[model samples]
Target: MPAATRHLARRFGASQIALNTKMTIETIYIARHVDIYASSAGYRMNWVTDDWQSVTGLPRDPPLAEYGLSQAQELADYFLSLPEEERPTIMLSSPYYRCLQTAVPTAQKLGLPLYVEHGLSEWYSPVAPGTGLHPRPASAAELRTYFPEIDESWQSIYYPSRKGEDVEQVHDRANGFLRALIPYIEHKFGGKHKRVLLVSHAATVIALTHELIGDRNLPLRVGCCTLTELQRKPGETELIGAWERKRLADGSHLKDGATREWGLEDIIVINDTGLPGTENAADSPVGLQVDLLPPEVLAHV
Candidate 1:
């Protein structure tokens, strides 16, 4: 949903946000989509208990598998390589095995507990029973067949398909879940500042941030694992709905000098900006005023 225009007035506070030098504490939410599953796994969107296990094969519930353990370590290595200051306060995942698995190493790197917020969960696209790599049983009798624990999970409250946790449920849960952290973010950034990091899906991030910043015109252009940083003025409202009108990357509109084009910047924004942040906005002057270093420039730093 787009944010209300009425909220636009709150974007710039009484003071001129276009100018200010406030150091803000940041929360880096890594939107991870590290490839864990093989491509042949087929479509498994709204996969249920049996389906999830078939693809991920018994998630590492405490005692985790050796393969899973190794994957976590590798992921942690990647995270540790990053500047220590960018470490996230809350390490979260989309409640998926792969995501949780990815976070295992991240949590280790950050030395923080993994907090499961339903808002960070993945969107449901309804995986057909047999279409999955698990290949749903030909009959109900066969489908019903499963280990006792798997059977128990069918009725588990945390399962994704249990009435209240559908696709729509995910969107709603995400909105509500992220709302809880707004104040914490405000405090972290010292009042209406911005932060950076990663995110997974495109929809939920757009929905949540749009509502948060109240930008109905927002055209979110965020992609997976691509590093992006946002900085806001102290009095200006936090980063929220602008998905429609602007581009998030610093070089979104790079001219015809083919080689000077914006690379890996949002892969391709959901909107014209090709990014949800400043890289693609009319606010380029303002964005550059604050973000002295373009992403390409920062890579070497």
Candidate 2:
């Protein structure tokens, strides 16, 4: 089949059918990691954060950057890549200066109003000046010590650990946003753009992915400016997933001696068509036959 035909079939529609596992998802979550920094040789600064362990359970500190305005500018530039109408979809951010600063670029990118939502903000950190989150190393191991690939960092960002909600809680939160936003996008811009870019912190991004695709340990590292493209089948009752990721150029993790690469398998959507005890038709697109990625086979290098 020709490339164009195949691509069309990958997206869900009343008549469209995904041809293979290499399906094209319709949604993309373009996440922005906070605390942008520049490495010694002009590499993008990443991993540095305003969330010191005191408030955040992270093991390491975010990189120190001259400022995050430039990073935000770049985000805006990407949005500007789209026509004015396309950028009006959805642009949400945290209340924090860094997060708001981070979102400015995307807001600029889409020319959409930045609707700040405290619900989607980073995890809560009770570690007061006198108190602290256990001094820990800023590595995957430390993060995993809490729960496999799942950690408090994600919990705090998504749920705030305030009153209720568990793994399912955050999933519902993300799902709620998606359910409402999907219609909003279609109404505002029609089909020109169904893509919704969420400019948020790292843990929040990872957690949101976990919500859509049923994998808590998904190896998705939403570093500074990492774009996760998810193409959902149109009119399909389920989320048939497809995507890929690369390190953000000039992002901070590269400067921290971090050696990483895409483990292609990590890019996949969970097949949640009729799974028991999960989000049903009411909450999600019902009867949606999603081509999913098994969590075990999904990993990143």
Candidate 3:
């Protein structure tokens, strides 16, 4: 056994004997990828008038915008500023170009290999019959050319379907990945007491959060480069322990707070339809209230 494993084994033995000591805890941090240069037509950044095909050649994979580069740096700095013990020992990122780009700086700073996990990849929304082809993210070998920090030896726990997944399917994917991932981490690191950082897309972030907390109805805020922290104590017989959300899509570390925040409602609509913000405006009471009030009354109220 490795030195860390031997040491952890001794500690576990001691804890078992005592029966009252606290078990080790693990911390998981999920971060959304920085702003993409472009996405689907309605979801593209304000300045990106060109289509994803025109800019990236790929249908849905666009590299981060210039400002996103700066945001990545800020994320790196934030991680670096954390105390040594609080820092993540392992880092994982989606195989997508944008996610890989977002994780590179932090991986370099921490001197950790970036593991490309397909399970953490962006949500695959269904492609309309004539709209276009579903995006196939670059393979690990292809991505290595751009990000040398990628750990080619590491394999993903699970891969997302190309056909696309509904909200519930994505949630199940996240849960399944977590079930396998916890054991993998324990074996690789010699214990479940590890800090892990995962960088993925907005939809994947929400899915992961929902799985971790065991709640889908709670409003989740996922924004560009936002961080969500989850922690759990070691469970005796369970592959995974009960997790608690310490932070919810927090972007306080960034100079500019969360931008382009998205929620479960937004993703569901986007997945069902190619367009974003398609919900009927009349359904909202705020809009109806404004329309019902006179101009003078609305101005003051």
Deviating ranges (above 4 Å) for candidate 1: 1-25, 36-75, 125-173, 184-202, 209-228, 237-301
Taking all chains together, each candidate's TM-score versus the true structure is 0.42, 0.47, 0.74
Say which candidate scores most in TM-score.
3
Please give the TM-score that candidate 3 achieves against the real structure. Answer: 0.74
lDDT of 1 by residue, 44-78 (tens): 22321233333333322122234334434555665
Off by over 4 Å in 3: 1-25, 36-47, 51-57, 128-133, 234-241, 268-301
Candidate 2 C-alpha lDDT tens digits along 159-242: 232222334445556654444344333433444554566666555566666655546556655555555545454455433122
Top-down TM-score ranking: 3, 2, 1
Give the Cα error of residue 273 in candidate 1, in Å.
36
Residue-level lDDT of model 3, residues 164-225, one tens digit each, is 67788888778777765655565455564478899998888988888777787668879888
Per-model lDDT: 0.35, 0.42, 0.69
TM-score of candidate 1 relative to the true fold: 0.42
Clashes, model 3: 0
Q: After aligning candidate 2 to the native by TM-score, how far in Å is the CA of 101 from where it should be?
A: 0.4
